[model samples]
Target chain A: MIKVQQEDFDVSAELAALAAGNHGIGGIVSFVGLVRDLVGPDNAEPALRAMTLEHYPAMTEKKLGDIEAQANARWPLEASLIIHRYGRLEPGAQIVLVACAAAHRQDAFDSCNFLMDWLKTEAPFWKLEETEAGEDWVDSRASDDAAAARWQAKPDRAAE
Target chain B: MKILYFAWLRQRIGVAAEEFDLPADVTTIDDLVGYLTAKGPGYAKGFAEPQVIRAAVNYEYVPFDHKLSNNDEVAFFPPVTGG
Candidate 1:
């Protein structure tokens, strides 16, 4: 499953739904991303007041579906779920969620990580952080590209 | 063809979307960027750093060298920061 919405979601409820009747699944791994109240250097005070997420509606869904599909193709997963939020969100608000289930713990864990890594670099959403200083569009981090790069290096493993 | 801009690119360019006739010689994303850059200062500033600007052809991410065709919806924006 995949969703891009402005409303917040209940992670527990979502997880329950994903594993409800799946008797074969033995493990589930999940990740949740949250907005931070602070920005800039770590020592800097909390300056981030809110963040606004913008996306190409049709394109966002399409790209997310592609990422989810890749995860399924790469793992022996029973189920997967992705929920990302948009619009103006305050600090500490939930921004995204990713969950995966499989017959073993390894597949669930690995696939969840893979899904997040790809989504960070490939998803179409853009974020604008608002602070006391001013609003600024967030830049893509080189670290994210590096993380996504590791996946490309081992295509054979990913296919297995 | 339709061109769309997002985030700071949209704000800088001063428009969300626009319709343009793809010139016969504009065969790729690079060619389209060159044509738009010649339009005015707004476009020039928005695309000041072509390296940081990303393009999507018909909603799929593509490089500047990607081919173009009539009636395609092309979008240009900064690198993605979503999770």
Candidate 2:
């Protein structure tokens, strides 16, 4: 499942839904993102008042589907879910959730990590931090690009 | 053609999306950036740093060298910052 919504979600309910009846899944790994009250490098600058997520409606969904497809192509996944929230949200509010289920812990763990890494660089969603100093669009980090780049070598190494 | 902007580009361009009558000379995403830069400083500023800017055609990521069609849906945005 891939969702881009303004409303908050129930993580437990969503995870359970992912693993509903199929007993073949041995494990599930998940990651949830949250808005922070402090923003910037080292998360030490600007006190965040709120966060507003902006995204291209149709394009966001299309890109997410592509990301999910890539994960499935790379791993033996039983199920996966990605939920990203938009609109105004307070600090500490849930912003995104990613869960992956597979027949083993390694696949579930690695695929879950790969899903988040790709989403960080490929997803169309953008974060606008509203702080007492004023609102600013969050800048992209090189660290994220590097994180996603690691997977580029994985397929080649696996084949070798 | 429908052209869209997001993140800081949208903020600087002062519009989320717009219909544009693309010129024949503007054949690719790179050319389109030049055309938009000529619109005004707001657009110029938005596209000033070509390296950090990203483009999509019909909702798929593409290079600046990717060719454009008159009816294509084009979008320019900054590097994504979402997780």
Candidate 3:
């Protein structure tokens, strides 16, 4: 399942939905991303006020579906999900969620990580951060690009 | 054809989208950029840094040299920063 919306979601409820009706699923891995109050990840001061997320509405859902499909193709995933929220959000608010379920814990973990990596770079969403100084669009991080690049090296599954 | 802008590109361009009857000489995404840049100052400023601008034709990302059709809906923005 993939969802793109402006409203906040119940994390527990969403995970339960993904895990339901799958008796074979032995383990599940889920990740949630939240907004930080600091401009830099390592910064101690909280200069950031809010973040407004923008996306191409027509393309956002389709791209997320494509990412989920790619993760399923590469792993033995029984079920997966992606939920992303847009609009202005305050610090500590949830922004995104990704979960993968499989018979093994490793598959669940690996696929969950893989889903987020792809979403960070490939998804058609951008963030504009508001700070005490002013508002500015966030720049793409090189480390994030490198994170997504590493997964391209060894594809676990071949084309059918 | 329709050309859409988002994020700062939309802010700078001063419009979310625009319509154009593409000329025969404008064949690729870059060519379309060249055509629009000739329109006025807002467009010129919006597209001043071509390297940072990302594009999609029909909602799928493509190279600047990707071919275009008169019916295509092209969008321009910046690199994604979503989780």
Candidate 4:
């Protein structure tokens, strides 16, 4: 499942739903990304007051669905979920969530990481960080591109 | 054809969306971008750095050489920063 919403979500509730009736699922891995207070040069001080997220309505959902589909094809997962929030969010607010359930721990863990790595680089959302200094559009990090690239170095499903 | 701009591009272009008849010569995304940049100051400024500007056709990301159709929805924006 994949969702893009303006409202916050309950992480625990989402996890419960993913593993609801899946008795075959023996392990689950999840990741939550939060809006941090730190910003500016060194990212050592608390400068960000809020972050306004913008996305193309239908396009956002389409891209997220594609990412989820790719993850499912690459892993032996019983279930997976992705929830991302938009609009003006304050510091420490939940920004995104990824959860995966599988019969083994490896698939759950690896797929969770894969989902997040692709989401960071491929999702069609933009962020404007509001701070005392001024609002600034966040830039795509090279590190993120690097992380996403590793997955492409090999075929879709290769035994690790 | 429909053209959409987002985030800073929308702010700079002063409009979110617009419709135009695709000229016969505008066969690809790069061609369409060149046409937009030649339209007016707003477009020129918004696409000042065309290399950094990204595009999508029918809601899917595409390369500059991606072919264009008469009724396609094309969007222009900066690199994605979402998680």
> TM-score of every model?
0.95, 0.95, 0.94, 0.95
Q: Which CAPRI level is candidate 3?
A: high
Question: Model 4, range B1-83, lDDT digits (tens) per residue?
Answer: 99999989998889999998999899999999899999899999999999999999999989999999998999999999998
| Candidate with the greatest DockQ versus the true structure | 4
What does DockQ come to for candidate 3?
A: 0.87
Clash pairs for candidate 1: none
TM-score of 2: 0.95
Ten residues in a row with the worst lDDT in model 4 chain A?
A: A151-160
DockQ, every prediction? 0.88, 0.87, 0.87, 0.89
Top candidate (lDDT):
1
The alpha-carbon lDDT assigned to residue B24 of candidate 3 equals 93
Best by TM-score: 1
Chain A TM-score of each model, in the order shown? Answer: 0.93, 0.93, 0.92, 0.93
Better of 1 and 3 by TM-score: 1
What lDDT score goes with residue A51 in model 3? 98
Per-residue lDDT over A1-160 for candidate 4, one digit per residue giving the tens place of the 0 to 100 score: 9888989999988999889988999989999999978766787665888999999988988988999998889998999999999999999999999999999898899899999999988888999999888888998899999999998896654564
| TM-score, structure 3 vs. true | 0.94
lDDT of 2 by residue, B21-43 (tens): 88979999999999999999899
Q: What is candidate 2's DockQ?
A: 0.87
lDDT per residue as tens, model 1, A1-160: 9999999999999999999998999989999999987756675754888999999887899999999998898888999999999999999999999999999998898889889999999898899999898899988999999999898887634456
At residue A37, candidate 4 shows an lDDT of 81
